[model samples]
Target: MYIPPSSTSPSAQTTTIMSLKTALISYFTFFVVFVDLTLASKHHVINFRSPTLYPESLTWDPSADHFIVGSHRHRTLVSVSSAAAVDTLISDLSLPPNTTIVGVSLDHHRRRLLAVVHSTPPLPIFNALAAYDLRSPHRRRLFLAPLHDPTTDRPIANDVAFDFSGDAYVTNSVGNFIWKVTPDGEPSIFSRSPAFTSHPVDQSLPHSFCGLNGVVYSRKRLPPRRPIKHRQNVQSQRR
Candidate 1:
């Protein structure tokens, strides 16, 4: 004769239901947290619609509430807004024809915009850092400092960074060094290292010859009052 199986006790059934409830709660909590994270990490995109204008670098202007972009093809500094409005902030006739405006830095304290202008390949003749008056009604050209290193055959000024004392440091990609420019528009080699040349480059990559493309200055990293000996000690330790 066949016998029926025993049913689960009431307590066991209650425990099973509680376990299922706990699992469902955990799944629901995870789903909510995942959705929250997805929403929090979402970002908005702003599209700039100039097909010919190949912009190389951009910096935000807090005072004007827009972005200042340097054009590689048009050789102009353009102001782009979040609303997709594109306007030429500066169209410098002083720049050589067909030259590119690679890097731009805005000095809010001095009310000036510094740009790196250079000629690419075929004939890389000109390389300079040009400054423009940001507050001027006509956006007047302040100064242009030629960045030519005698040792570098084809020095390309790739990027610029301004220090607290209104001095500008420009990077030479081909020569792998930095050029320092004073407020009076005097340009000189600031820093160079054998390590820059020693860094191995991938032969398969395009423009593998280029080095030291960008630069930045931080006051906090090395305080002005710090002793030279201390700085030397730090450098020696790092080496």
Candidate 2:
């Protein structure tokens, strides 16, 4: 089951871990936690009650008034409605056989859904960025941005970010780099330096050998901050 915040409140977006064994309904301003289980029923201001397999990430789509979920076991995306209806938003990306869809984000300005595709098997693991058209449900315009790290054996694409220009930036957890995707869906190396190297000095620390996880870009002039998970950051920039 998946729980998406019913409202846009800051408190609603609080980070939570949904236990796969328990079932409960929570209302957050910006976030919702989905535990592993079968949905009982849908109630007021809440829906998306059902069984889901390997749900990895979710993002709220204000235009469609629904939450988009990515499957870690399947390379697909689905939308859950407040009325307890589930719909297939994207699937059959025609990627490699073992690709899994992990992170998802909405590019409101571009009217597109950006996703990270992690491919397993076929040695020297690589990741790709997928873009889907949001103009209509019937048209499945797919664009791919493939990435790899010549220095590392395994590179995992985790999350995505958009700069002020609407260009997409993706986070590589294991490779310690940020990839930039053009509006046309072309991908290129945006930034990769030794500064992103993870030391893993203390096991007790939340730090992981995977350098970076989540990132955010701002239109304001403020400094940009990237969240280093054990994994995320928001910054303001001038438009």
Candidate 3:
């Protein structure tokens, strides 16, 4: 049966068809990753999902002031800045073909970058924590030092963060757990279990959990200091 096209013009129909194809391709390519960039007018843009490749995670480097795009299939990290002609490839790793980057963060003074790679096969749901030392100009690699227990195979990474003290934090979407990665490559728990979670599955029930997605190190305000009055009355020796 010959069905009419959505539009009368042939070009319109062709355009529609092309759009659908692109959408499907994007979905398949970027279903495992999500990114955000706000430097340009095209802010809040999802790079890989727009006729691009398997886009993993997106982040901003204050030093470079550029957007970083990481992918699993490509196993590469690309950076795009307003000054550059196009995205520049930074790191290439031997990670899984279906890996997805969940978070990216940076520390300015220390000249460091942290990334969390979640490896999922046939599905984007595996718990793996990968990081990189972005200070080097020649050495580009994704060093994945597993944080999860070797015994308990869990799901994917949802978020990552770094503190001013060089401490790292990660969120597991499926395991309902959070881990803190030390500067010395040690993994430990940052918060209590169920740290970050999704909404309740029950449609009738109403609840909200802060969906832990991008864990970035930010400047948290310190508590105010107490006022101290030192009254050293010039001891005028009125002897």
Candidate 4:
């Protein structure tokens, strides 16, 4: 149960939780690798060595024509398509040391990227949200949703995503609830499904935090503005 700390958006004027540890061993008694399979041709299948995935969210950018996958511990997104892995797009994110990610998005628009990172505080221990800069790649910039208080220094962010209208939503594992954070500087409850709370407290791994998958946005549909109050100046006049 480790969370990392994130820097406040220069404009959003908000605090974010982060994590500490960087190794996957913090959540499991034993180290385990993940495996996935897909059939490309009618009679052909292929297997590849993918990271032990912790699905955050996914999206596709028709402009880039790739599917992005976010997981724990890494700062790159798995660029996927109907073909195969083109390349791993790195993100600019300052994550908790030894942090592993589980979420990601694929959009031609927007600047802030989401992923599930795990780490432990005081000694690199955590399990929280890992933010990245889309403009930049593979650079750990800052935590957007810190879990522990800089004073108390004890909090964590589980997972994060944005709704259809660009409302950022996150799973506050510590609070045992999902939060709907409006770009308008407002936060609300999005989901409280028992599945989120039922998760075991021990080095037990998450068994499907819902879609816990990826998000996709077509480049042709890039909103006139970046992402509403999300990527622009925090001072926004609500309609």
| Candidate 3 residue spans exceeding 4 A from truth | 1-51, 123-126, 141-143, 149-153, 193-199, 203-211, 216-239
For residue 119, model 2's alpha carbon misses the true position, in angstroms, by: 2.1
In order, what lDDT does every prediction score?
0.89, 0.75, 0.62, 0.51
Give the per-residue lDDT digits (tens) of candidate 4, residues 32-52. Answer: 322122333236333334665
Tens-digit lDDT track of model 1 for 60-155: 999998999998997689999989899999999877889999989999899899999999878658999999998999999989999998887788
TM-score of each candidate? Answer: 0.76, 0.66, 0.58, 0.45
Please provide, for model 3 over 183-213, each residue's C-alpha lDDT reduced to its tens digit, 9 standing for 90 to 100.
7767876775442443455535442232345
Count of clashes in candidate 3: 3
TM-score ranking, best first: 1, 2, 3, 4
Model 2: CA > 4 A from native: 1-52, 121-124, 193-195, 198-200, 203-207, 223-239
Query: What are the clashing pairs of model 1?
Result: none
Tens digits of per-residue lDDT, candidate 2, 30-68, equal 233332222434435754643554678889999889989
Higher-TM-score candidate of 1 and 2: 1
Evaluated at residue 221, the lDDT of candidate 2 is 88
Off by over 4 Å in 1: 1-40, 202-205, 222-239
- Alpha carbon deviation, residue 112, candidate 1 (Å): 1.0
